[model samples]
Target: MTSSVPVLMYHYISRWKNPIAVSPELFEEHCAAMARNGWRGIGLDDAENFFIQGKPLPDKSILITFDDGFLDNYVYAYPILEKYGHKGTIFAVTGKIEPAAAPRNTLKQVWNNECSADALPRVDQPYVKHELGFDERQDPFLNWEEARLMEKSGVMRVSCHSAWHKSVFISPEYDGFYQPEKRTRTFDRIDSDIIWGLPRFKALPRLANRAFIPSQRLLAAIRELVPQETDAAYAFFAEEANLERLKTLVQGFSKDELGSYEDSMSLQGALRQELSQAKTTIEEELGRPERSLCWPWGAFSPDALSIGKDLGFRCFFTTEMGPNPAGCASRIHRFKAKDKPASWMMMRLQIYSRPWLAKLYSSIRL
Candidate 1:
């Protein structure tokens, strides 16, 4: 009889400001633990046989997947897996994979014939926040050279994440979100954008000038509501109670001025484009078909699933914290393998290995 095994999901492999990030040390420990134990890594073919053809898996089978295609995946995660004799699948953001970037650090210094797994983290740069003044719409990702090495070695399977992870994070209506110069986001630069935004809006390019900066009155309201330091203003914005208020304030702008920034963010078209590009590019680059897809932020609608099926992606992985139900592997769920220690993950694997326990927990949670 077939049993449901755990599929682990991961994001950035770094020590950064992100809550989703997992440190390299901790990650290595987790992989080592899996290797020390009897856990075996499975490929897309193994998964397809079990899920699509209803074939049972080998003993103690597990699936490791990484999202976003961060360069750190190669720097940190890949070598560890290779050393431990484990395997993984990196669902890469295709469009972000190729940029003429040097190694971030000096370990081995090889993007050419000298390419070894020793010195990487290529491109000496910090993990710049995308929302900041940096044009990080497609950076901090693996170059084709690194990707090809990983894929050819059979240690990691390079699959598809999507074309651009941007449309998923940035609000479609917030034109100012993209324009770092317009960002008075820092505490020291608390100068209200409302004073100069309107004139600048008229002067800038149509697509470039899309953010709806706060009006003078709205700025005053935010100030009055928080009335202290910049931190208080930020706290107010951070609070859930301020969402409706923020919406009301944002609506004060003229529709013509705000443009589609105020429009309901429908990413169906964007998702289609991304999925198509990711599949095509990954296949072209890696010489393998992309059969699985992990959604950005684990947010996907029914329409997205439908579109994915049409695009030939059979497996859809989500952020939902639970085990994949037996015979229902088309839409699988995974828990974040970051933040927690290896021991915690060990316990999670234990629970998942026993279907009855997982079923009981799910039933209670549901």
Candidate 2:
């Protein structure tokens, strides 16, 4: 049996309160406690050696990672790691740090750089700019200056989370959650896409296999919900690719044609483009190996993994909680630590990071 090495994940390191937002004071305490106990914090290579190569990590060894590249990471997490003589990895949303730099953008924010990463912006979960609502914009992300400084200082190594960290797949509707925050923003640019997107998108053929969705009726309901989509988009449906594409499923289509199948397909290209660009940008900017990819939203499809692997990304990280044994690179499991005492964190980690213990705990969690 292989040793179960624990990889800890954290999001925000700020005073501002939200789920998964760990405060600076508590973060520092956690790091300091680990340091005092002679725990060794290792890098991505160390984990790869243990999990992929079947080599052993040092006893009391741990790997710490931060997701979404929030400025609070630079402002607080970076400094803490440095103070304790430990190192961690940051899987960043390269696009949120600089919106205009990417080739493709799903959402545009009048990015405010004047604010520092430590200022505690009012950002909530799913911290990427493209996934966020326009009104949720805040100045809580790290700029190049800060990220470069940390990279130079050797406190943390940077890797790509996504170019935009966009939630391209695993939409709310797909999972049957229907949460607004989890709604797909793929067609967000087009007014009609946003005005009447979800109900119409629900009619896509791929999703039809999951459950019995009344496609014609759902399209009809969208017409009533936003009559303008019907009036504006209806006339072109007969001649457009959308009608032909949707005709394979849900025949007798008496509802407003969902605008442009081309538009929806275009969104997928944006996701792949972001994945590729994030690798390129990180390599160009930080001079680090863009070999690792932590899936944004912990969302991965066979297609997503194939795309990343094709691009030379060998190490994959995900939010799926459990101990991953050797040779589990493509679906490496990680769990987040809360804003609690170091002992509290360690206890939770012991329960979740060990395979048998995690299974036992999961069985009794209810």
Q: Give one digit per residue, the lDDT tens place, for model 1 in 1-366.
A: 338778888876776545667877788789878877878767766766676656888767888888877787887777777777878888776776876345353222332436564455543234344443333332367778778787788887878766665322122144321112322211112112432122223222111122233345544654454424433444454566664555565567664434323232434555566578888888887787778887766666676677789999887776676666555556677767866788888877777666687777656766
Q: Highest TM-score: which candidate? A: 1
Question: What TM-score against the true fold does each predicted structure earn?
Answer: 0.68, 0.67
How does candidate 2 fare on TM-score?
0.67
Model 2 spans > 4 angstroms off: 99-135, 168-256, 260-271, 362-366
Candidate lDDT (C-alpha), each: 0.62, 0.62
lDDT per residue, candidate 2, 70-175, as tens digits? 7667656776787788889888878777532312210111124544444433433333443333222344566666667667777788788877653222221322
